[model samples]
Target: MTLDDLFSAAREAMAKTHSPYSKFPVGAAILTEDGRVFTGANIEVVSFPEGWCAETTALGHYVMGGGGRITDICVTAERLDECTPCGGCRQRLAEFAPPDARVHLTDQAGITKTITMVDLLPLGFKTEILST
Candidate 1:
């Protein structure tokens, strides 16, 4: 799918965010190399620091749908322009996507900047290191 399509999916997911506490709705869309798309929204729980980020939710859907090589990702926030993933989300994304995978940051108007997973987490721990 095109970046625009992915961004649109994220926006739709943002509308479904269950962030009653933070009031900061966020959305994420993942595009697998096989052309499958998965979307998710931020979910907040009563317990502080127990909430999940939009990217984490998207990764959950991607895993349940039979994980594949993630080629691209889109993230957007209802209140922030060009919202990027959080540090934790960056590590989570790096676990599934390659260093070169494109990360599209979007605003209400659509994608505003494109970055790579490596750019988001230059010193991220590689899953390969854990395999041994």
Candidate 2:
């Protein structure tokens, strides 16, 4: 699928956000190397700081779908343009995505910037090191 298709899925996911406290809806879409797409939206609970990020949720779906190489990721926020993943999410994404994986930062109109996974998390902990 194209980047636009990914963005569209993310946008649709954003519309389903359950951000009652923050009211800041965010969406994420992951494009796997096998041509499958997974989408997720931020979900908040009554307990503060217990909510999951869009990227985290998307990663959950990716994992459940039998995880594979993630080629591209798209993220968008309803309140901000080119909203990026949080620090926690950067590390989480680094665990699955390769250094050269494309991360597309998008707004309502479309993608504003495209950065590599390494660029997004230069100092992220390597899974290989953790596993060894």
What tens-digit string does per-residue lDDT give for candidate 1 at 83-113?
Answer: 8899999999999999999999987999999
Whole-model lDDT values for every prediction = 0.94, 0.95
Global lDDT for candidate 2? 0.95
Among these predictions, the greatest TM-score belongs to 2
TM-score of each: 0.97, 0.98
Per-model tally of clashing residue pairs: 0, 0
Q: Which ten residues in a row have the lowest lDDT in candidate 1?
A: 48-57
Error of 1 at 104 (Å): 0.2
The list of candidate 1 runs beyond 4 A from truth reads: none
